[model samples]
Target: MTANASRAISWGEASARRMERQFLARPAGRGTRVAEVVAAMLGAHAQVLSAAEVSVGVRAAGVTRADVRAALWDDRSLVKTFGPRGTVHLLPAAELPLWCAALTAIPTGPSPFPPDVRVTEEQAAQIVAAIGEALDGVCLTVEELGQEVVARTGPWAGDLVMPAFQDLWPRWRQVLHRAGQSGALCFGPNRGRKVTYTRPPAFDPGPVPEEAALRELARRYLRAYGPATPQHFAKWLAAPAGWAALLFRELAEAGAVEEVAFEGSGAWVAAGDTEFPGGRVRGVRLLPYFDAYAIAARPRESLFPGEAYRRALAGGQAGNFPVLLVDGVVAGVWHQRRQGRRTTVTVELIGRRLTARQERELGEQVERVGDVLETKAQLVVGKVTVGPHA
Candidate 1:
């Protein structure tokens, strides 16, 4: 049998290695830059802006909320855009082109929009083009974008045909993500409180080919959360299963990836990135809801074993609850409440107990979080009375 079919890798080793790769086994060195951390974590989820800041701040040493904002607005090193699973994310600006190419390469499934209300492929293309022109060198809120698109693409593009947030949205809004996937749009600095969009500033060496982009993206995903199956990748990106399977087949045929036995099932890892950590991961982390590490790790049984499978998960969906990870596995649930300079972090262990040293480590973790957010955090080891997310 080929090494791909015979070599076995266990879940413990996989989880440990993944933790280190995600900068969770330990805080990354002080020199680890914000953009670098964002890239390694496969983009911080930005739906909850403060949570995204905390996600990056807690992982890399010396990275603060100010640092993340500076990298986003000042350095222009990071770009806020629609990313994996069609969620808002903060991706490294330099990789935007490849991200667009790779994401668009995925075979999209049927639209959720009703047939009569949906934009045809041609209409979506027109809206995407109009969005590019409208956002070029200008920042526009959703309302502003809608008006400019109507001017450019006619009344059909401005019809209130799509449903959103218990109300109707413009037909062209359906293609908002398409604009992001085409590298024609991204989030700009917020105006007071409203989110704005802009076309990224031009840079040398434009987007790579779709095939090359998809291949490189697969490799990057494996590097960050490797030994993963096509199903895992598909679920992570909300892509069609058949498409991801074919992509993996193409990768294997090209000798770019190798199949391996993970736990009991078969999985693939990038050919050059099969190395596992030599020791167990030792630490406790309070990962915010939608944190990349909490969302991307596989073998849900192992990572969320026992009570965690019941408590930390929300109706079987991961990343909806702030997880308390012990030695890289979810051991409890936590919630945080911020008031001015002081934040109260509440913990509720479901199945396991931390040793005295682990408790001390948890205290240090709280302090470290305070430093990152520039707040004072108090840790409470009791019932988490607050609701799920902070």
Candidate 2:
């Protein structure tokens, strides 16, 4: 059959189904540690207690701290999922290696700053070496490591270390891989046993060719969020458009991915034609900031409403409120407040008033958020109200 004919399924239906399957697929003994569940569902972004707001989102999704813990430390569900900016997501364990490979391969854009301000290839290599040495047989906080890096790299390096490092962060996986190779770093507790990072313990030095990594990333993208365009992948990876297209083509030629048409948009999917889980949409959701669900798609406007999208992308500085999803569409915005002990949640509807059912569903979610925070919560329906008690 032609590619267009092969992918005639409804996109909305597919997305909803995927959500349901993933949400309900929790194992029998899963614990509710928000970090673990976030990692499992989203990938590498998981960590205990750290990024508390994100943890709140996981809880709002009906996952508990115990569930998250079980998923990570027990079920080993943390893996890597690729999306915007080639960032590694904390996906389930089984999916980790594949996602890692994919992100490692994608080519990135040139530094936005001038070459003098940027880390040169030689400087990057030196920084990597310094980091490896500093981290050898020990875990250091960012502050501590900064000191060590500055000490080792010398005064001449000045503050150039951090700027250069931040710029080179897009390629951090490469340095991490090398550190793992040299026994300088391995996966270990970070941020007070809440997170994991490459630190000395069980570092491996296996070979990972560049071409192979890129191809694998392409395959995983198609498998998880496919029937998408090369531009989508490029936007997601924050990589050069031409390189992303080339990588997509390579994967398609290898039979790892297939070009498919969804609506009028040409997209790609995993060769196996695996379907999403939710199987047609239903209830609303409150997605957290920087959530993969928000970052994974491209031309993001297509997924959320215009006003809501602007608020969300504005980095929250412009009173851009938290989002409220109704049947997979951006329906409104919401916020939370904490005082002494009580917690209050306020939701602002943008268009149609929330139906009784939507209000009840939202209330249930608000309570779930309270349960995760171990605080008493009250839901207040309104528009743009702020205070410790709203």
Q: What is the TM-score of each candidate against the true structure?
A: 0.96, 0.74
RMSD of 1: 2.1
Model 2 score (lDDT): 0.54
lDDT (tens digit, per residue) of candidate 1 on 1-390: 123335688777788878788788877899888988899898999988888988998888988899999999998999889999888899998888889889888888899988988988899999999999999999999999999999999998888978999998989998898798778899999899999999976755865899999999999898888789999999899999999999999999999999888888899899867777655688888888799988889978788998889888877778888888888889888888889999988888987788999899899888877878889999998987665554
Q: Candidate 1's C-alpha lDDT?
A: 0.87
Worst 10 residues of 1 by lDDT: 1-10
Give each model's whole-structure lDDT.
Answer: 0.87, 0.54
Give the best candidate by TM-score.
1
Candidate 1 clashes between residue pairs 3 or more apart in a chain or in different chains: none
Q: Taking the tens digit of each residue's C-alpha lDDT, what string does model 2 give over 326-356?
A: 7766677677777866888777776668788
Question: Looking at candidate 1, what is the lDDT of residue 221?
Answer: 90
